[model samples]
Target: MAPEYALNGLFSVKSDVFSFGILVLEVISGLKSKGFYHPNHSQNLIGHAWKLWNEGRPLELIDICLASSCMLSEALRCIHVSLLCVQHHPEDRPNMASVVIMLGSEIALTHPKQPGFFTKMESHEAGNQSSSTNEMSITLLEPR
Candidate 1:
């Protein structure tokens, strides 16, 4: 069976795109960022990056880990592309083909729409429930 977070049945290709975007940010930042947090703020890392981009301060969100080694333009472009993958509507997200093209070329990119998650209030609750159920199922099957 596919493990949770395996991006199997739980996620479509678009979802994988979202995950890839998150992974890129985590790799650059050396921080694990989850999508559902903050009751008042519906924005996750992608949303935060989008906001920063809109404010013309995208660099502010860069990881301190890259402070000395990272190229400014490349890092900014990665962030911009990551935000594009996490757009609210799945149809708005680019397929892997277009994503590669966007990354490889200086093609004009579209602005991302607001991300999925209608509210942040249920984020923790839902995650906890899913994890708990998975654990329980495992425990029940183990030999006592």
Candidate 2:
């Protein structure tokens, strides 16, 4: 979750950008952004990615399917770009235009700061939760 939206309930373009970042990571890692488990890390996917990135092992986040086919530099570039999108503050996140440019070029990317809402959920806690309010259970709305 974007910190502002998660904490204050204000959604904006940047919030969408934040979601995009997590989705990108999810696709690359073959894991859910939230409730991702690894006995070794005991942290969510975002935190795990950050940890691996700092340790110069960002490629470990790539799913095995992609690892076999994807180029090392390209995969690392995607991870780097995703991290920039998920920065702790909306202002810190690249605008869509910047993101597009960043993805298309080999230009140096600014190192990403820690991401927001990065935390662990033990298996029991993670599995027992109900759907979030942000989810729309039904197609249409009704007047209350």
Worst 10-residue stretch by lDDT in candidate 1?
Answer: 1-10
The best candidate in terms of lDDT = 2
Each candidate's lDDT (Cα)? 0.65, 0.84
Report, for all candidates in order, the number of backbone clashes: 0, 0
By how many angstroms RMSD does model 2 differ from the true structure? 4.9
lDDT of 2 by residue, 1-144 (tens): 788898998986798778888988999999886547776756778889988999999999999998999888988999999998888799889988888898789999999998876776766765543545685476787899
lDDT of 1 by residue, 38-70 (tens): 344555555556666788898877778796798
Error of 2 at 138 (Å): 14
Error of 2 at 28 (Å): 0.8
